[model samples]
Target: MEHYHDRRLVEQTWGSSNAYTGSNYTDYPYFPTLAKQLLPNLRCVQVVEWAPMSDNVYNDGWDLKLKTPDGDGAATAAVASSQLADTSLDCMFVYFDAVDLAGHSSGFSPQNPSYMQALENVDVHVGTVLNALYARPNYANENWLILVITDHGGIGTGHGGITYEERHIWWIGSGSAVAKQQITGPDPGTYNLLGTGIFNQSGVDQAKLKQSPVQADIAVTALHHLIYETGINPETYPFWVGLDGKSWLSQFSGVDKDMERNNIKVFPNPTTGIVTAWFENPTNDHVTATMLDVSGKVVAQHNECSSTNKITLDVSGQPKGMYVLQIKIGEQLLTRKVELK
Candidate 1:
């Protein structure tokens, strides 16, 4: 289990082993750490490692017991309920591994009674957490985005292989921000092989077996809702360009017009100093570019009356952080995020 955390840290950091050394997961830039840095007022909590043999500690700000009790799932639920009651808590990550344990002990198929029972137990625990969330005193005014996801699936009694069952998993998100629609994967032709074998079998175009949602999108969706609810500019954080997925909420609605049309292209996004924006076509209209900090205050501005298709914003003098870039040309307006390292 501890190795699992290490491997995940390595993967998230783009295979940078130097970022995670000697069982220290805090060295990596995790989403929770970034969230706390972005919003000091926001309280992030993590409850993980329900397995008995697991170390049960991955990163800082974890507020649960180190040892799992006999009924670990129920214990996790109790902690989740208690944490959700805290008004200061802005985000909480709870992990329950009873189903995984059951699958490993018995079998990873629906035909296994023990695995099914473990799933049912976890479902009850999830229900308890949801009940506690709804019981919040300020639930009426608060907006929450609840996401449930799994790292991987299993085949027979074990996983970790490149089998289709081990790769194919599901994600469930429910909240005010999430659209009330089910997103499923494209059908892998021939229903006969669906239940009997892996979906990515020979003769099936693996490229066409794409899905509407991805696991990486989970982080982006959470960040999007957090920014929207807190009224913080997305550019305030330097990790947007490094995000591996797009927000699911942005897929159905709230699309940025400037980004949708791709009329302007920003290169070297995570730049150290200078950033360039190339327009699709040259504009004769007067162009004005304003650079704003995290507080929405203008830190720098550029004005160009000459006809050109490119604009450059220099933030070499500014501190290392994220800044918003707004460009106005005639009646057309465009916005971009700039990262200064």
Candidate 2:
């Protein structure tokens, strides 16, 4: 297990033995872009991150508290509510991958006190972070809205998805910016990022807060909002284009609540040998589907029938690993990850 963990780091940290040492994943380019989006010309955008910790040191992975101002909860509150006593900076975004880690490792059961204790510790950590914000000046002005959320709800029954339990995460807000503001709208369709958080965008007016049904777009969504809100041109950010699943951040500009995209599908993703492609209500006509191997070689091609939205493929002989499944409908094209079994 230790080797398994170390190998992952060696492979990612030092990179492959043959690698020309391309940018480390940490240099993913978006970090600086995010920093620019949040702080702009300002500095001291401190990002304190802490992962799995414990009340009992016996199981280091399960503990949720540390000796300092770090932990998923602290990071989360800093992003959601406590920007600073003066709001001297623009905004913040926090991430809590701990609970997800715990779930992945321990299955979210209270069978071990550590699981329950970790959850309790998160609550306590959140309480302290909130206390710090309220104890400081200007935070009570209610100008702030804090959004508490899990990045993505974890698997229930040892799995992950939008299942009722896995998908049902939390969202909470308290401050002057959001007072009794309730968001009611159509469900975000098909996306896996829909209902995994509870939050309040503190330090801003609730009326101006943007509502998005598709959570998959938040990376781009937040970046664009910050660009406009902070008066920064997006072209200056090299990583902005790849931050979101799609490039046109402005396309989701309006508050039309209906969120549906029935444009594409790749079935039986972990295909045992065969899989089918389907196009649903595409915005274009004359669609074509193709399967390409990892080396970018075309393995199969089909001129999909116009009337049928589906195309079947005999992928039984393809090697096991990742392959690109491309669907081209008129001018629109999308790629989905396909795994061969």
Candidate 3:
């Protein structure tokens, strides 16, 4: 589905005040606003603190007050469950802060009873949301990718410093599209020496350390799944470029193979002038082809494509550099990389 609706619900709780109610919450590059503009079908439902309803279709006023972690989680779960049941809702981001509040109020350690209890409570809320997702009437026909992640880990009663406990965090991605393998890095050899209160990685291999996923991967992964499934390249709209993280799904067995099987063949990739693309299967939909520079600026385009399996574009006059060629046949978008030498 090229056009899909998205929802974002963040619970009002401790440690998330800045993100939910701070002055900069509605500032530029604010994700909810940017997403709404980019994805026309987006519908955001924010349960934040004191924020008025957004002017557009972005927010449905659900502003709430500070409450216990469990309470906030329950509220978020209810919103998520309700939104998930709506067939028009394609993607949803639900945030629960009870565990973080517990960690901040008490010590962030296994021995801390409050922290452990908070984790248990959040787990139940997660189950509730997942159950709602699976119970959707179109569940069997939908390809949903569920990702759970935290911003940071804590040390003792607080966090913020670049210690091992404060930096290392967990990420879980589940769904039919997700890989079955675990993503891990080489042991940093800090487990036994954690009691020493030292968090440096002097002897650790930086290359291996880079193997672990970072925070940026979450957005890229979500975008990759959306683009692959919907067959719409957001980059065609001249955005989603210059991303920091690589999609982890590409490393495992999944959509890449499926795409290759139905791949569009483009020859003379390092062409001096004209480039031709052949669709493996015939399509009756109207076709539009566009070529964009590495900076996402459209340089050339062709819109007179007929009901044929092949289309060609001429970029011989453009500067010698790499460019992306996007072919939109009805709602299915196919992309090819071209180089002018």
* Top model number, lDDT: 1
For all candidates in order, the CA lDDT equals 0.62, 0.45, 0.60
TM-score of each: 0.63, 0.39, 0.63
Question: Ten-residue segment with the worst summed lDDT in candidate 1?
Answer: 190-199
Clashing pairs in 3: none
For model 1, residues 250-281, the per-residue Cα lDDT tens digits are: 54445551232347788788888788888754
Give lDDT tens digits, candidate 3, residues 7-64: 1111110112223332233221333333443344544444321223232223321222
For the record, the alpha-carbon RMSD of candidate 2 to the native fold, in angstroms, is 17.6
- List, residue by residue over 1-341, the lDDT tens digit for candidate 2: 01111111122222122122332233232322344533335322323343221221121111122223444465466554444454554344444445545666676765655556667767876776667567666555533344455433434424344344543433444444234544453443322333232121232232322342223333344444444433323423322333322212334333222222346677898788687987763443676777766544667677764656787777677788776666666655555667887
Q: Name the runs in model 2 displaced over 4 angstroms.
A: 1-39, 44-89, 109-114, 138-143, 156-164, 172-175, 189-341
Q: What is the lDDT of residue 260 in candidate 2?
A: 22
Candidate 1 has which clashing residue pairs, if any? Answer: none
RMSD of candidate 1 to true structure, Å: 8.6
Rank by lDDT, highest first: 1, 3, 2
Error of 1 at 286 (Å): 24
